[model samples]
Target: MPGVVWIALAIVVTIALVLGLGASRLRTLSRRVGSFSCNARASGQDAWTAGIAQYAVGRIEWWRCWSLSPRPARTWYREQLELVGREPFDDDGPGHYLVRCRYEGLDFELDLAAGDYFGLASWLEAAPPGRRDLVL
Candidate 1:
């Protein structure tokens, strides 16, 4: 093989390896308890970015699917998150719901599967009695 051909092969192999590793890591993370696939969009924006949401005590952490960083890209505290609205999401496909929420006064939306949406609702509703907002 020519020198150029060798270099091209090496580059392609490296790219494939990186993508494979990233995907494998994502699959592993998604299999963990309380983790679900979701897409998020900042309020007023039309783009939805793929990610995984993990429910942690007192908070929800989201990690972008394509990122290699061990830290979550975004975090919403149970105390700060307020559910604004929810509706069907047609942009992505069926069985997806768009949840509009406000955290610390900033609005954002999470696109989730029906099951995941129910899970999120349950998690929020299961907050400690002391943490629940009492309208009285």
Candidate 2:
């Protein structure tokens, strides 16, 4: 009975160590994500850059997601009604957002940043060509 107790203690210690390490990592991830922002206007490229960089080198395990999995990310973005008539997140636009860009296998965005939300759509989606208002 004493031998079983010793083995159980060792297993518990190992699990504790692993969880402690991961918890610390989560903290670092949170910090990085908080301070991350970028100006890649086209497709919100800058934000994606920052998001990936932060998601990488963090205490989280979402780094190098492309290396971890060889599939495209599951894209998610908030939809806004264009009263005049248009969809946001214009799939055909020039910007992209960091919806599931970080933290794989789960949804990452919780609170929506007005800038991140509106800006992403503006930067990424292509406007209708005639809307440019240029005189040839």
Candidate 3:
């Protein structure tokens, strides 16, 4: 009977330790690394645009973001563009956009296509409002 109790305690301790490690790693990754700032002046644009940007700030995190750079930022943006029409740019259609979006608060612009942009928006939502407004 004593052996059984010890075994159970050992199992519990092991689980707790694993959970604690996971939580610790989560905390570490959640830390802000000070990237994703943004500024944009497109080819034909005269006005300078800027915003506070935040995204996962590590090498792996960035590559994950890069994977989602284009597509549709949000369902609304995708739908709205569809309603307006892709126009002479129609060939690219909703997925046609190959944009160099300035990551709000990050110095460099991420060049992305519309489909790729969809996943990026979810990441951007981690930021505060108007903090990720890099478009245009």
lDDT of candidate model 2 versus the reference: 0.35
* lDDT (tens digit, per residue) of candidate 1 on 1-136: 5999999999999999999889887997799898999899999997889999999988999999988888899998887787788999877689888899888989899999989988888888788787555110
Tens digit of per-residue lDDT, candidate 2, span 1-136: 9999999999999988877766664445446642333211222233331222222221212232222232212322212112121223433244433232222333233122445545433532433554332111
lDDT of 1 at 24: 88
Candidate 3: where is the Cα deviation over 4 Å?
34-136
Instruction: Tell me which of candidates 1 and 2 scores higher on TM-score.
Output: 1
- Model 3 over residues 1-136: C-alpha lDDT tens digits? 9999999999999988877765654444335463332333343454534322334332113312212232212121221111111112233344433344322222223333354445455454444465454233
| Structural RMSD, model 2 | 12.9
After superposing all C-alphas onto the true structure, candidate 3 shows an RMSD in angstroms of: 15.2
Q: Would you list the rank order by lDDT, best first?
A: 1, 3, 2
- Poorest 10 consecutive residues by lDDT, candidate 3: 78-87
lDDT of each: 0.86, 0.35, 0.37
Cα deviation in Å at residue 39, candidate 2?
Answer: 21
- Clash number by candidate, in order: 0, 12, 23
* lDDT at residue 32 of model 3 (Cα atoms): 47
Query: What TM-score, computed on C-alpha atoms, does each candidate reach?
Result: 0.86, 0.34, 0.30
- Residue 23 local lDDT, model 1: 89
